[model samples]
Target: MNTIYRLLLVTLFFVSQNNQAQKRIALFNQKDLKGWYAFGEEKGKTNNADELFSVENNMIRMFGPKAGYLMSEQSFRNFELTVEYRWNTDVNVVRKNNNKNSGVMYLVPAETPDILWPKGIQFQIKEGATGDFVFLQETTLNINGTKTTPGKSVVSKRFADAEKPIGEWNQLVIISKNGVITQKLNGKTVNQGTESSVTEGRILLQYEGFPIDFRKVNIKKSK
Candidate 1:
């Protein structure tokens, strides 16, 4: 009995160590876009791109002079991603929408062209509708016990609004494991889906013609 109890203690120690090993590291170094690039509709990607996306005060500032996505240099899978963002309405000289819009896109396949909207899962970032999931380019996800059709956008009308006031920081957590995905804003699981058609690919921060700031872009692998 003594030996069995000792073995069980050893097992628990290993389990705790393993959980600590799966550390959530900051993707943004708070210095520069070292491991990211830009792709957009115009004046971006495979051209002399302007500073539509820049790093300021340890936060990623999307000027949105041109609409585009700041693509990560690496692809990810089976991970939990967290980011803090706020609308910089103070810097917007030409705010496109009164309801400001942007998004965090994941599982963007590299084979597809970098159009305005590539095939991936988008956690839509918008006013009064921040937690909506936008399936782009025929992407699919099962939500609310119903299998969403290809190229369909399922509105999370049932989820409660979890966004902070404008200009205040809002934390968005996205967890994708196996084929299941969950979107949480301000600590609320506002949207979730299963059996996603997309499982692993690159991530993007959309610059949808609105000044925004993102910080603490961190990620950890999910079990």
Candidate 2:
């Protein structure tokens, strides 16, 4: 009887642990852009506007004239986000001269201005600058144990260059919990900060006058 009781208790504990570990949400449905909405200069103009944000070959492709972003309809907090992205070889005519630029913006407040860019912390995605941090609209962060207060756009360089070559997919892992945020690129920890002004909000993928492809936007509550 004693042995049976001990086995039962062990089984229950494993079941509880598995349940907590399996709490994950797929932000992008591979078939289509079901839970996302586009915002930019060309939004709501015509049916063709949707073409800017479309699912092609099981990846979300952003290619169009205007510069804007696709925002998640839901907000999240205290989670770990994983996504893969690659730069498209075709750049828009207007932005061809400049290096490609895109980003994953998170912790946007509810009252942030509805403009080309919102008030949030951005994981800077650019040519040779992946994993850099950008604080938009006076947002604040504590970097390397020091608090930063740039009046407008504050940029923090990543600790190392971990981006793969152009056209190859790179993985990004962003973990935000208890006001602390850490960014990882290609499985390397590149940047981390604490005491972020905004703890929770929607996620935004930027369309900074360049073409990009994204896949597997997955999130799960941090254990």
By lDDT, the best candidate is 2
What lDDT tens digits, residue by residue, belong to model 1 across residues 150-172? 76454444276899999999999
lDDT for position 175 in model 1: 94
lDDT per residue, candidate 2, 19-92, as tens digits?
88668888997888777777777563223325557788988888666787887777887889998999888644
Worst 10 residues of 1 by lDDT: 43-52
Q: Show model 1 residue runs off by greater than 4 Å.
A: 1-21, 46-50, 91-99, 152-158
For every model shown, what is its TM-score relative to the native structure?
A: 0.85, 0.85
Cα lDDT computed for each candidate against the true fold: 0.82, 0.84
Candidate 2 error regions (>4 Å): 1-22, 44-51, 91-98
Q: For each candidate, C-alpha RMSD in Å?
A: 3.6, 3.5
